[model samples]
Target: MRLQDKVAIVTGAGSGMGRSIALRYAKEGAKLVVADLNLAAAQTVVDEIRDAGGEAIAIEVDVSDRVRAQSMVDAAAHAFGKLDVLVNSAGVGNIIPFLDTTEEDWDFVFDINCKGVLWCSQAAARRMIEQGRGGKIINLASQAGRRGEALVLAYCASKACVISMTQSMALALAPYQINVNAIAPGVVDTPFWDRVDAQFATLLGLERGEPKRRAVAAIPLGRIEQPEDVTGAAVFLASSDSDYMTQQTLNVDGGNWPG
Candidate 1:
């Protein structure tokens, strides 16, 4: 197993990309903390991992809450004695145009997408420092962060913040031998995308699936991304293979963002 004996915390593990990364980690022999805002969903992942003979625990956490994030780290440490990896995968997206956006919309995006990352990274880094074993922190950024998109102002700004924060975190944690990185994915075939598409289908004059079809057509790879497509990158960053790499946002969008 590539991650034998490692303990990892994967937020938003209930569904979509987060769930895939959590399952991949478990299969690689890592003891996992499958965290999600939805308790039942998280538990389902835990059950799946356990059934597959992997060790895992499910925790319901609203990552935007600093205290809750800290408690999550405490729970992980209490369960497995140490935390070797932290994947900040819990996030939400907004597709509204800038003119139609509201304060609540902006705050909501920042709170969960940006501030959530800060809370989780801080909490995990503290534990890693205490353990003196070093650690890996991976943030889920987006192509929107690299450059502006047609809509989704709040989401774009928040992801840009994540990219900046990843760089800052890598610098601060480097002295401790901890590596920090971010993944900027364009579009993936996930449940979250279905939800996002549903939200704006009316405005686009098409259904959720139509927009996704168009997105896939736009990708140079001739297909939209799958959750597993990102797991390879996640494992790389979380393992020693990427020990020398930090403070970088690797685009996993199948050449959608050429810049």
Candidate 2:
């Protein structure tokens, strides 16, 4: 149990990579606060963890809201008595063409994917500082952040923001012994693709699913990434294994892009 005795708050824990990390953290013996926008999905995750004899609580929250974000941290500290780790895995994406991108589109994407990370990490870091113990703050980035994409302009920029924030936060929080890092996942085959692919179908004039097929075929690993593929990296970052590492955004993209 790498994370035994640790208490972690995982945003977006209702599904996708967040869910995978939550379940993985529970198995490794972390008390989890499963926070998500969907109450039912979050509760279901808590139920699964409890069924496995793990400790967890589900909290429905929109991480973009600063107040709610602080409350999420408060809930974690209140429920578990201490907070040791935070995985800012909550995000949203869109595939609008460069010219089609709007102020609203950028705001919508950044509010959740970038600003949400900011709100949550600030609150968690404050608590960690008060607790006087080292902690881990892992942000969810994307391969798209490493390079610009024609069709997904806003998403690319937002993830790039996440990476930038990871660095700034890591540098700033290091004195408090909090290691801030990020996981840049590539093409993970999850419900997330449904919305992106559907938008690409109309934007790129491709048949439905063709965009995803192309994405998978481009991966040097020869397959789409799964949520489980990223948990190992998360576990390492959240555990003492990566105590000396900070201000780094590790690429867990299965060779889709080499950093």
Which has the greatest lDDT? Answer: 2
lDDT of 2: 0.95
- Put down candidate 1 lDDT per residue, 1-259, tens digits, no spaces: 7899999999999998999999999999999999999989999999999999999999999999999999999999999999999999999996898899999999999999989999999999999999998999999999889877667788889999999999999999999999999999988888778877886686677865787778789999888899898999999999999999999999999999986
Of candidate 1, the 10-residue stretch with the lowest lDDT total is 199-208
* CA-lDDT, candidates in order: 0.93, 0.95
Clashing pairs in 1: none
Question: What tens-digit string does per-residue lDDT give for candidate 2 at 1-259?
Answer: 9999899999999999999999999999999999999989999999999999999999999999999999999999999899999999989998888998899999999999988999999999999999998899999999999999998899999999999999999999999999999999999977797888888888888999999998888999898899999999999999999999999999998898878
In terms of TM-score, the best-performing candidate is: 2
The TM-scores of all predictions, comma-separated, are: 0.98, 0.99
